[model samples]
Target: MLFLTRDLFSKKLTILFLIILGTYGCKTKTSSEQTAEQAPALVKSPEFNADSAYQFVQKQVDFGPRVPNTAPHKACGNYLVSTLKKYGFSVVEQTFKDTTFDGTIINGRNIIGSFNTANAKRILLTSHWDSRPFSDQDSLVKNKPVMGANDGASGVGILLEIARVLSLQATKPDIGVDIIFFDVEDWGATEQDTSMLHSGFCLGSQYWAANKHIPNYTAYFGVLLDMVGAKGATFLKEGYSMQMAEDVVREVWTTASRIGYNNYFIDERGGSITDDHVPVNTVAHIPMIDIIHTKNSVVRTFFDQWHTADDTMEHIDPKTLKAVGQTLVQVLYQESANLAL
Candidate 1:
């Protein structure tokens, strides 16, 4: 939902600025040093149930597009809160009113579920829940609201499956885990709309970053998922994630590669996205990285069904979900074991 606007001259200037910053700020450690510090330790992660994840995605889409001010949106929110409560996590719902770019007042809710609540060391996982209001990118159905099976429900579904696994495990991690479902993230102005407002998207994340549920809250790191369930989705090292949390990004990409998912998790830089992670990194000072799908084509920068009514359950692939979910579980389990030592 992040948009960057610039003229041709300004685009060149921005590129120059990035090159200068990269030259001055970016540094790399030798492979030997990295290998010595981060030994090849095999950690067993929890079983990732792709079927469960797929069902979760379908459930949300069945409720129709979860656009703000709609009955479906309210129902899905309630369902998420109730489901998390059933999973034995301490749930907190942050509700607030936000004004969109075109001066539309809408209700937004950020649902957070905390595991091992007493532990101070923590990691935050998040995804947006609200579907895009307008399918402006669609050539034929430009006025329709997108179903957002991949955009909205896919990430949340993965997190929900993670929660289910964490709930059943006997030995919990020492560090707390927060699964956050942000709302009203896709209610921004369309590309055709000429309103030069940057703050339209990611409303719920901005609110949570400013008014954290826990006072003076901080986490060791955070990971965000977006458009992750598409078929043959490649998660390149997103530019914004590299800029914000290079260490975390490296850890995730390396873990994926070691776990035989290098084809999906490529070790190359993608475009700089302005997703929910941006607000968390900038305002809350949390080193957060986004695992999002990116394409190298002019047809659609995202997936084929992106922002289209055609984005349905058929596009949801269990293999992609398993790749992301299993990699994350491995990371968390390894981190927990290190903390125990």
Candidate 2:
């Protein structure tokens, strides 16, 4: 995913999304129409373990930064595949090569694990697992690797914990759930605005969306998680998601509120973040929303320790993980129950 301060014009998209959504008033959605992605969900939601999620985050951090082509990256990727398979998921490793913004031909992998694959009603959950090679945001050692405790690992951790929880359940859900860990998402050149070239960042998502694991693949909707494991992380409804999947955004935010996570899932509008979800919605034509954190205060222009060396596990908060994890489980369980009905 690309990162920039509003001041960086030459290298940023200059997302004036506030002007697009913050100042504007939204029309009320009809209560009669149930959200297609959520109508089938059950009232009883699944449990999400914050301790397990935190351990998953720590496990990834123990491997050091998962920079592509490195030993840690390869080992971590293999670990993810093996772990998902252990959880009884049908795992597929989609590998591809792409040229980065700095003209480096890099290998990328999109690891997809499918549950209840035959179910027609499916929900896609995704997070980029690769850490940035250079923490350009760091004042010192700007070229060193980023820890990515929240930026990459946190989202994946929540999903992995979700997978673990599903596997342990006595009964499986009627609806399908697919979790994808995308690579090469944080390797874009900070000095270049590669968005103009249509190949800025998120190479794995760009590849998977165009050439999906399954031919003619489609999900009811997708939710991409990023920077979801920090203290006081606020998830504003992102602009691009509203444009592509307004119903999905509403469904997720409403579910969060219903489940007592209203504090984390704020109703305010967030900037148009260009993340993995963009490719899923655009290239694959799947309505997807990004549950990502943007600058929620004047003190910090980004999430806690974003793209910096400080994005370590110490800054991670279990409560934040619980909020995101529990909310997602609620949505899925609701879907599962609704489908059975």
**CA shift of 57, model 1, Å:** 0.5
230-316 per-residue lDDT for model 1 (tens digits)? 999999899989998999999888888888898999988988887899999999999999999996667667888888888888999
Worst 10 residues of 1 by lDDT: 190-199
Alpha carbon RMSD to native, model 2: 13.2
Candidate 1, TM-score vs. the true structure? 0.88
Measured by TM-score, the strongest candidate is 1
lDDT of 2 by residue, 236-302 (tens): 9999999999988988888888778989999888788778999899899999899998755667746
Clashes of each: 0, 4
Instruction: Judging by lDDT against the true structure, name the best candidate.
Output: 1
